[model samples]
Target: MSTLQDSGEKPSIYLHRLQVALSVTIKRGGISPEKADQHLLKQFCRGCWDNSLIADLQLEQKKMNPPSFAELLLLLRTEEDKCTAKATRMKQHLGASKQRVLSHSQRAWMSSESEPDVETTETTPSQEQRKSSSAISQPRTTTSKTQRGKPKPWYCFTCGEDGHIASACDNEPNSVLVTTKRKQLKEKQRLWESQNPSADQSPHMAFIQTNGL
Candidate 1:
């Protein structure tokens, strides 16, 4: 069932196929009938690719005691029926509105010679649009997790380029400015490293390790 793709199949038909598969699995001694409900529920959910459908079942899925396979199928069938009915009503409303417009246009054309006021008490397009759009089901809103975007790039102070520091930069290193800076750094380290060891102070960890510990 996890391999089953939606392929534009209706929920009812999908559930039917799932039911048949579960039955076959049970008859083949693949799964015990006692645990078939749980297996069936999982396989059904795995087969559903629609986020909205999954969202609709989240409440049931999160329950302390999850709904049975039969209950899930029944709920899915009800949802499918509701969606079909709403779609049918929306089509009927749109067709009626179109017919009304065509009828009005024909009448106006017939009386084109004599101009007369045509009263329009028809609902506005916005109203009809809202009415038609209301048919779509709204999925449950889930809070999104905090996502870290591409990590802030490294800033190079030497060349002011991103993604690298001065040490890692691959630009020309023989420049006078770079040579002078490196000389100054090495001189400072040499002076520090050459200082005599104080009697009261402890030796450096590296010096101790280099010696007999």
Candidate 2:
């Protein structure tokens, strides 16, 4: 609702959009026709930038209620038309008044300035005619002091070596030295499985059960 606004939209345009939104909500079975009408009217009023028009409609609504939503829209539309017409008339009048004053002032100024320079005189527009023609127009290039560092060297984590990556390293992982117990566990499991020919347990399950896993 905070985002809902008429902007320059006519009441009918705004109402059309509002009806589209309300139709979906109304079909979901909570809001009735009368409640929806109230919401539409309230939100339309809230969305309108013309406070005077909304106030007038609200006043007339209190004095004599509209028979339907269409009737209410008719009332609002009538008020909007009247306000628009009045504003147009006021703007025209103001513009005409300003025009009259401007013309009178212009006449006085022109009469005073007419003695100084004649229109028949020709003056060279040296400054306006002077334009620059570039031999080579290129995009600007800038070098910053912050870009002074040399690129760091590449190193392999596999064998603690430089100049090559880990993926290309030929040596086996040095981590195998730390996991010697894992190798022992695998060897013992293989031996036990060979000894017990009728084992039906899951992989490593027999090893874990027989040992202190």
Candidate 3:
């Protein structure tokens, strides 16, 4: 049927229908074989069908004989199969490329999830508390040593006087002279304490020593 030219049939099916149309036209007989070829070529698009096969058909007709329609149909089928195979290969390549891209994306997502966060790697509260306690405990021993080893003031220890010893209390010396007189006063106080173990031992002696005098 002429309508079969536009149908979504395979190229081989359309070629078979075209051969039937040619046979029916030839049996009706007013037009010659050459005229039938020209009529069919006009009814169908030369470029949409195979231009090379149409040229071969015309060449065969000029030799005073033509191939059978079945032979022509076979050539059309061969070209169609080659085109179909090429299209199938192109589709396969496209599908493989999409799979590779999906694999890469999945790998990146897995690596991101596997890594540890910065906040999670940091020190815990218990570790921080231990460090603070050690720091607080360290200062106590150092503070006690500083308190016990501190230097005494420039004053007499026995009588609690500013400038002179208990034996020189009658002289009443100026306080400014104490800096040069401190060593000699310390010697005399040492000798007095050594000789009089049960002497005055006044509360002022304890006060002077405790106050770092």
Clashes of each: 0, 0, 0
lDDT of each: 0.46, 0.44, 0.44
lDDT of 2 by residue, 28-108 (tens): 775775576666666666665555556655633643333344565557567656655654554366543343343332222
Instruction: After the best TM-score superposition of candidate 3, give how far the Cα of residue 5 lies from its true spot, in angstroms.
Output: 2.0
Model 1 stretches astray by more than 4 angstroms: 1-3, 59-64, 95-213
Estimate, for each residue in 1-213, the C-alpha lDDT of model 3 and write its tens digit: 253343223445454445445555566784566665454444433323444544544633533343434354456566656555644454366443343343333222122222211112234448776577567656664543332211223344344454322322444545555544566656756665665556565643543444334
- For model 2, the superposed segments whose C-alpha errors exceed 4 Å read 1-3, 59-67, 96-213
Worst 10 residues of 1 by lDDT: 140-149
Error in Å for residue 41 of model 2: 1.7
lDDT against true structure, model 3: 0.44
What lDDT score is found at residue 117 in candidate 3?
16
TM-score of every prediction relative to native: 0.40, 0.38, 0.32
